[model samples]
Target: MILIADSGSTKTDWCVVGNSGKVLSISTQGINPLVQSENEVERVLRAELMPAMTYISDITDIRFYGAGCRDEMITVLERLLRKVFPAAVNVCVYSDLLAVARALCGKNEGIACILGTGANSCLYDGEHITANTPALGYILGDEGSGAVLGKLFVNALFKGRLSDKVRTAFEAETQLTMPVIINKVYRQPMPNRFLASLSLFIGRHIDEPDLHRLVVDNFRSFLVRNIRPYCRPDLPVNAIGSMAYHYRECLEEAARAEGMRIGTVMKSPMEGLVRYHSDI
Candidate 1:
């Protein structure tokens, strides 16, 4: 049996596959070693994850792919998982970006991207990443991500780029004036999450020409700034995340404009991950 987990800032999806080919699914709050302490992560593993594994002892392998699982965080997560699943002999922790590459590209060489709360992209050579353009988070980069889209939309709303009617509707619906938005973004915690949450409003108005252009332009920036650095124009750009899935039309348009093509736009990596592991 093997256990696999794909984690992001918001949630984690756990899959348990038995030797008999049976699969069980479970959901738990996300675990980010970069943000949460070891005790906090261990608490979730024991309280939420452990209870879901009825055949825990049968598991001999564990793979954890998640956001913030890098450098020292990898060791931290490996220690916790080892403590939680002591029966497992093989344990590996990897970045969520690698997970996207593996899930979308499989064993084929291509460009893989993640457009979620934040943005990330890499050139994958089937089994490993050859190059990456740093995301630099929502503030410095993350062009096509939900957080950046919301940032652009909100900026347009307040800076007179959007129509008064649209602004009025947004303010009325979200009850977020410039003051509230300022507080939420500048003073409050998890500003990226707060900004990403506003993408729902952008999605609702995406059909409008201005809104559509905004989304397309955002994706264009992502391609120009992030993917272009790889200089692999011949490779089809594949992506995994809510931002890529929900706004696929806009993403497709941007790709066409950049003389690129879209491939394997998956909303989540769990299903593909399961398939990849099953095949292995």
Candidate 2:
């Protein structure tokens, strides 16, 4: 059997594919090397993940793709996974960026982008990433991402950019007042998640012209900054994430305006990843 995972900041998708084509799947809280500790990862995998699984012995390979998975971080996750899946003969850890490339492009070359709570893009040469634009997290970058969209909405409300009717409805929907919103964003933990939660308002109120324009502008920025650097007309440009998948129409429009061809805009990489590992 083979185990594969695609982990983001908030959640992870897990798939166990047996040799006979049987499959078992589960989801667990995210395991980012930059976010959770080694002990935390082991605890979650052992308690929340392993107990739900019926098979482990036949699992000969494990592939983990995640955020913040660099050199030392790779070692940390390998150690934890080894402890949890003791019988596994092989375990590999890589950056979530690589997962996106493999998921969206497969063995063919393309430009890959991730528009989730955070945003990132790279030029893939079929087998590996040749160039990339740093995702600078939520604060400095993360253009067209849920967290940034939330930040924009809050700032607009404070700056009186949203109409009175829209502001009131938005407040009603989010149940956030000026003071609580300020305190929560500035002092609270997981502020990125908190901000990202508000992006749903844009999806719900997509009819509003101002909101529509704002979303388009964000996508345009994403393209100008991330995609165009290494982008070409021949290399298919694709994206995968909740934000990209949900706002596909807006994204397509933006891509058209930028004179870039858009390819797949899947919400997650699990299906593509399952097929990828299946052939391996």
What TM-score, over all chains together, does every model reach?
A: 0.96, 0.93
Q: Give the clashing pairs for model 1.
A: none
Question: Model 2: per-residue lDDT, tens digit, 68-164?
Answer: 8988899889988888889999999989999998999888888999997878999988878899988788899989898988888888878989888
RMSD over all Cα atoms, model 2: 1.7
Residue 172 accuracy (lDDT) in model 1: 83
- Please list the residue runs of candidate 2 whose C-alpha ends up more than 4 Å from where it truly belongs after superposition: 20-22
Residue 151 lDDT in candidate 1: 93
The residue-by-residue lDDT of candidate 1 on 1-280, one tens digit each, is 8899999767999999765554899999999998899999999999998888798988899989998998778988998999988899999999998999999988889999999888999999988899999999899999999999889988888889998878887988888889999999999999999999998988898877888999999999999999999988889999988899999999999999999999989988887788777778
Residue 198 lDDT in candidate 1: 92
Q: Which has the greatest lDDT? A: 1
Question: Cα RMSD to native, each candidate?
Answer: 1.3, 1.7
The local distance difference test score of model 1 is 0.91
